[model samples]
Target: MDILAKERKLLELEKQVEALGNNEAVNKLKSEIEKYKHNEMTKLTAWDRVLLARHQKRPTALDFINYMSPDFIELHGDRLYSDDKSIVGGIGSINGVPFTIVAQQKGKDLENNLERNFAMPHPEGYRKALRLMEQAEKFKRPIITIIDTPGAYPGIGAEERGQGHAIAQNLLKMSEFSVPIISVVIGEGGSGGALALGVANKVLMLENAIYSILSPEGYASILWKDASLAPKAAEVMKLTAYDLEEFEIIDGIIKEPLGGAHYDKRETFKRTKQAIITEYNKLRRLSGTELQYRRTSKIRKFGFFQRFNYDNLGGIKR
Candidate 1:
């Protein structure tokens, strides 16, 4: 019931997703989670959801990459600007099969946070991501991305380099990419910073992670001119896992450890590896034509959805 604790909430959510024995009891819980019925998630606050995404104990992209794959070959620089530490990618082998992974890392400590820019990609960061993704295409290797950022750095320098265009380019590039691509939002997938690396044949998110256009504080600041009501805004935004999943924006959910990825790294990593491998196996078995169809078909089916436009003034245009 204490959903404020990311770890505990994640464990409960994991139990909901996994195969809990006693069919009758499981069915009861399942029914309760269903929105059509009395959903327990109705109690969540917007800021609470955002906090879960940025929880101190949440697993970082690096943590997952370090354990999930071995002997990673990291690449750097945008070839246009300085290298951005926020984004790291290169040739890596998962289960001994070579592939390229683009992982966006958030800071775990003050020093690390400074280096990673709090996982906020600058224009160069996005450019670097774009460069590596091109490499994946050249080698005919599948692309896997881990998204974890509060959002792109919206500073004068970043804007000068065309941050919007950089993100747009990535979206266009990934959509038409020739190789299999899967993106997983491990935590705090915010705005264009996250979307720059988010396009994929299939997208996944951990149970406690949140993916949204903006963080609750930013949303609150813009809408209410007050950053204190982020929790209220989070509920309004519906940035949680079940919310996005039900909307069909993401393809699947990667169940985390009992308390969350941070709670049990080994267990969480195992589950993550299984999900990645399962998707890889499914994609790898198909022929070029089949893969192409599968890829396009998966995208063409997405709902371009419309929502009530909520601007800062409490004015929602219908």
Candidate 2:
């Protein structure tokens, strides 16, 4: 069988083992499964990493919370319309460091994904995120945002409810917060939806995650009239963590497990937690105003280009 088929078989076996509860037989089977994982995930290309980022077995924000933070108390509601499940935020402690954690939740299965709108949050979600950030600021607790959205929901309901305004508001307000803000792009960080929660003193990306204005498929459809050219688009877009790290678009990278995060959840959680702690500790040393200035400075330094010298065009004849 192909690697894809083998992966599916392994996933099914894992579910069966889970359903049967733990046993010596199950433990042995689990060990056998682990042996196959490294082979299944061969050397990955950018497009392969994209596929892995969207893999159903991959851990999401809630998974990271459960593994990395204890005593998490989830807060709900935008207080205007209703609570948006796509964006999960609350108070939590990471190794006893109090923080307000906001995360984009892309559900585990099709039914749950539909329920969370595949993690494309609405206006209320952004509003809800801002509300939580303000609370974090009020309490002088640090803020950490996990960004994993395809983009802000562009549905009529979301637009009518001021989705653009809501995201814009978050960008403006989060910058003024008097507490440390660290944003992690754990998966698909797309456009303003990702940015709404990403105005942070430090921005981190998982090794396999992609952060960009839009998906490669979307980029291809708009520019090349064919979504199948997405592989080519992915290369040119420079959305991978490695690319972003070189461009200084992100503060640092949380290295994934050998095959990917899905291959080993515990290791990924450890790496992510360490990256957060290290970066946050550095930001914590700075005063609130200094944090804001550094964040603003870091953002402004991105994507600048020098004017072309037309006067020196076509190579001088000297």
By lDDT, the best candidate is 2
Candidate 1 residue lDDT tens string, 1-318: 334553356457657656676677777776655542223333545455566667787878878888888788899999997999999988888998888999898888899999989988998988899899898888889999999988899999999999999999998788777788888898888988898888787788887789988778888899999998777778888898888889888878887654346667778778887898888887887665666676667667766667667686688766
lDDT of 2 at 163: 97
**TM-score per model over all chains:** 0.80, 0.86
lDDT of 2 at 201: 90
RMSD per model, one decimal: 8.4, 4.9
The TM-score of candidate 1 is 0.80
Winner by TM-score: 2
Q: In each prediction, how many residue pairs overlap at the backbone (N, C-alpha, C within less than 3 A)?
A: 5, 0
Residue 193, model 2, lDDT: 89
Instruction: Output the lDDT of residue 108, model 1.
Output: 82
Model 1 ranges off by over 4 Å:
1-47, 287-318
